[model samples]
Target: MQADSDPVTSGMIRRLLRLVLGSKGYDLPFKSDTDRNFLLLLVALMSFLAVLACAGTLTLHAMTQRWSSGLENKITIEVKAETPNGEILSPESVKLDTEKIAGMLEGNLAIKSYQVMNEVEIKKLVSPWIGEDFSFDEIPMPGLIAVELSAATPETLETLTQKVLSVAPSARIETHREWLQDILRFVKTLQGLAFLVAMIVVVTTITAISSGVRSRMAIYRNQVEILHLIGAPDPYIARQFQWHAVIVSLLGSVIGTAAGLAVATLIFHLSGKDETALIPEIGLNYGQIAAFIILPLLACLISGTTARFTVLRTLSQMP
Candidate 1:
């Protein structure tokens, strides 16, 4: 019902005609729209993509929250087998450096606690790569310290770095936040891509609806011309397109959404409920479930509106 004149008033008037026509008043043979099934297939595929994209966006959003909180206010110290002056040190030196780092942590009021992982733990970490029997006595192994802080501010991190460097300049201090930052950025990029795909789905659905409307109009041109000859308003003709499009789109959307969620549920179960799964138990909440349910209904409304506008425009151009 868009117009060279007022769009709102014209839309209202067209809708009034549609209401007056009800479901029974049409001069055109509704069965003559040969592209109906094709349009439904296209709409169904687009709606499926829309649902998956939304689910991905929501899942990644949840991952961001879980991952960020994991590293909050935490840091790690890697005590390598090196001296303050960048010289390789003996295993004894590395252990002494680790002990010094631990002592520093114990004395610092800002640190809540720290654990210097034993040689057995270090050996266990390396065993998967170099074999279980690999002896650390042959090569000086790096030490690790897990530190928990009461509060980790810029000044606190700076002070901790200085203290570690004083003991062993080669020691590496990690707040464990760099990896988390990279993960968050990657997740954000994925979320953006999902949103972009959803928008593409919307545009594609509208395009499909428009194509169906025009194709039907072309196939029934003689009947439409006779209606024009009889002095029927364009709105009266447009309602036929509007309701048919709505019914077709509604059916497509329901099929697509149900299929999409079914696939999602299958994948979710395959991902396993492993408590150790990095992504957490990825499942839709009530809100997300409701959104999927609402998506098909929205498709109905959009297709109907697109059909109305396409008719008004196409009929105005016809002789």
Candidate 2:
């Protein structure tokens, strides 16, 4: 009965004191206002860098998927203007060879669809490198045919290439498989680097909190000794410092996350206005957004744990 009513009696006393003292309340003096503000700024900076790294990783991953999907199961065939007799073929002969290759591709079971590009289309493709005002009639340009395959397999590709070569000996096939592999490898490397950076930032934050706790312990050594003499336990004293660290880190992380998100939003808005911009859309799916939202709480947890451990270790070393 005494243990059951103890909590109720303490609650009533706290309420009475609150009523008499208005806003006055008891709090530990582990950190001054300046100390807290500085910690908050430090945490905010760390959080901002972390958020940027996370967002960049997500964006790069999205880009990799988009690029791979767009290029998958796609191949291009170019019919050069040359004959088997080591003589230059005329434009008319090139067109005939291109049509023959397209007809063969259309009959192939592996090809889903094929289109032979017209002279105007071929000219437009080369206009970027050669001046837009250049004429295609004076120069003999190879014809381009884009083919989409239903089943992308090595055997199917080899068969299709052999069939095209049989029809047009000068035709060459290009597949994006090698290029895509290179791009995927690069993206994976970047993601790994981003993760490493975020871990470093977390470690730095923990070290900063641990240092602050040690500094505070030295400054309040006399007060801590008195508390110990009065029979205060290490855990009870540690809670005060731990809670302070949590509050400071939480506030800073919130501010930093908000700032990072705001910058991302602005960039997305601007990028959306330009259709040709290479910047991938800055939209996070639900899972990614949830992860970002939890980052601040994670920072607080790290700070609190660091403080608790530092305080306990310091107290253990005391005589």
Q: Write the per-residue lDDT of candidate 1 for residues 1-319, one digit (tens) a residue.
A: 1232433323443354456566343456654345766777787888788888888888788778877776777888998786667677888878888898898788789998888999898887778678887678776789899888888889999988998999887899989787888888999999999999999999988887898788888988898899888988998888778877776677778888988888877777777667656577787777787889888988888899999999999999976
Q: Write the per-residue lDDT of candidate 2 for residues 1-319, one digit (tens) a residue.
A: 1221333323443344345334432135533335666688889998888887888788888888898887788999999876667677788889989998888877678889888898788887888678678666677788899989997889988898898899988999989889789879988999999999999999999999999889888888888888777888998778767777776787789888888776765665777788756555656666886788788999989998999999999999876
Best by lDDT: 1
User: What stretches of model 1 exceed 4 Å from their correct place?
Assistant: 1-27, 84-92, 107-109, 120-124, 228-232, 273-281
The C-alpha local distance difference test score for the whole of candidate 2 amounts to: 0.79
Q: Against the unseen true structure, what C-alpha lDDT does each candidate score?
A: 0.80, 0.79
Q: Give the TM-score of candidate 1.
A: 0.79
Q: Model 1: how large is the Cα RMSD against the reference?
A: 7.4
Clashing pairs in 1: none
